[model samples]
Target: MRKTTFLIPILVIAAVIGLSSMFIVDERERALVLQFGRVVAVKEEPGLAFKIPLIQEVVRYDDRILSIDVQPLEVTPLDDRRLVVDAFSRYRITDVEQFRQAVGVGGIRTAEDRLDSILRAETREVLGSVSSKDILSSDRAALMLRIRNAAIAQARALGVEVIDVRLKATDLPTQNLEATFDRMRAEREREATDERARGNEAAQRVRAQADRTVVELVSDAKREAEIIRGEADAERNMIFAEAYGADPEFFEFYRSLTAYGRAIQGGNSSMVLSPDSDFFNYLKSPNGAGQ
Candidate 1:
């Protein structure tokens, strides 16, 4: 019975030691075996792993890509324009052994903090070399690529690989926003003023041309009317000369009658003359002789 009791205790202790020594590493995880706070072995593949019982412990880290959001920071471009930039990064622990050695017991959190600093410094350096227009434009993809490349060099020391760096938002600072809007408004107003001035100049030119055309048309019509009046007067004088040559006495009597009609037109004219005056010849005789 005593031997049976001793065997039971031995088996129980062995089982406990076995359970504590064995560990599992999932496909999504990488583990480090630490002895007295120092890493003794690294298990990168997913499977069963073993370590000394009561002397070592297992520390696991995510094997998948991780993300870190950098706090928004201000960057000044070469143009001296300041912008607020929010960014994020993707990274993966490439060397588990190196990662543990660099960050010690702090693990992923410590690595992330160090990575954030590298990213911030690289972002400022790359973005500051360009103009604000480039940072805010579609070319920002190229700028982001530069940041990732620069960060990759520094992140290797922390045993992490920088996959990508991207700007989430780029904006003018609150104080600069109003100033930028005012400048834009002023530019638009200047363009409008130029357009209006051009329109007014064109209108003035058209109006002057119209006035000149009107004067030319009126002067042409006046010259044509004067020519027609002079030709009509010449024709009337020619007709009178031919009539006088055809009949002397009749022409003389017609002249006298025309004179009398003019002197007494409207039957309200008054005149005093001798009875035997030559002006009465046509009234006294049809032949215009005072017989």
Candidate 2:
């Protein structure tokens, strides 16, 4: 019983010591062993690792890429068009030793802040050289590439590898957009109104011309009709004159009878009678002595 009691305590102490001196590195993590707060060794592979029991400590860093989203910032294009830009960065700790020596475990936030400042400055510098039309058009990719190259160089000095730099969103502020749209709409409406006015003017001119043509046509038709009627009347007069010349005695007798009928068919009115009156001669006409 005494031997068993001693052996159990010894085993417990050994187990505690073993646990304190050893650690496991996961495939997804890299560790740095620190002694008295100084980096003594770095373990980059996954496996069991040994260290001093109480004096040494381990600091672990993620081996996978980390994503940090920057706050939205205001930027301007070459045309002085203001916009809000939201961006993010993807990075990984490539050299754990250098990363630890440069920035401790709690320095990721500071690194992101620094990177954000650098990215914002460089983004403005790069995009400021381009026009707003180009920024909104097919040249956005080329601008992004240039920005990434500058950002990568900046991030490398901090012992981090920049996987990518991306602009998530670019937008004009609401108030500015509203003003711009209003101006654009007004201009378009002005153009449309001008076009409609020109069309109306053309239509009025064409209608006036058509009215004048109609008047001329009516006058031409009236002239033609009057000429035809005059021609027919003249031809009838010539035929009548030729017939009257051939039969003078018959025409005289016929003219006397026509005059008697015209004088007698009348309402009675008082008239002074003369024996030599022409009307009376017509009433007595059919006698050959009447001239």
Best by TM-score: 1
TM-score against truth, every candidate = 0.82, 0.78
Compared with the true structure, what per-residue lDDT tens digits does model 1 show for residues 1-291? 999989999999999999999999999989999999898999998999999998999999999999999878899999999999999999999999899989998988899889988889999999999999999898789999999999998999989999999999999999999999999999999999999999999999999999999999999999888898888888887888899889977888788888987898785678999999998867777544644
Q: Indicate the TM-score of model 1.
A: 0.82
Q: How far is candidate 2 from the true structure (C-alpha RMSD, Å)?
A: 4.4
Candidate 2 off by > 4 Å: 1-7, 240-291
Residue-level lDDT of model 2, residues 167-249, one tens digit each, is: 88888977799898999999999999999999999999999999999999999999998998899999988877887899976
Worst 10 residues of 1 by lDDT: 282-291
Best by lDDT: 1
At residue 46, what lDDT does model 2 achieve?
Answer: 99
**Clash pairs detected, candidate 1:** none
RMSD of 1: 3.4
Q: Over the full model, what C-alpha lDDT does candidate 1 score relative to the true structure?
A: 0.92
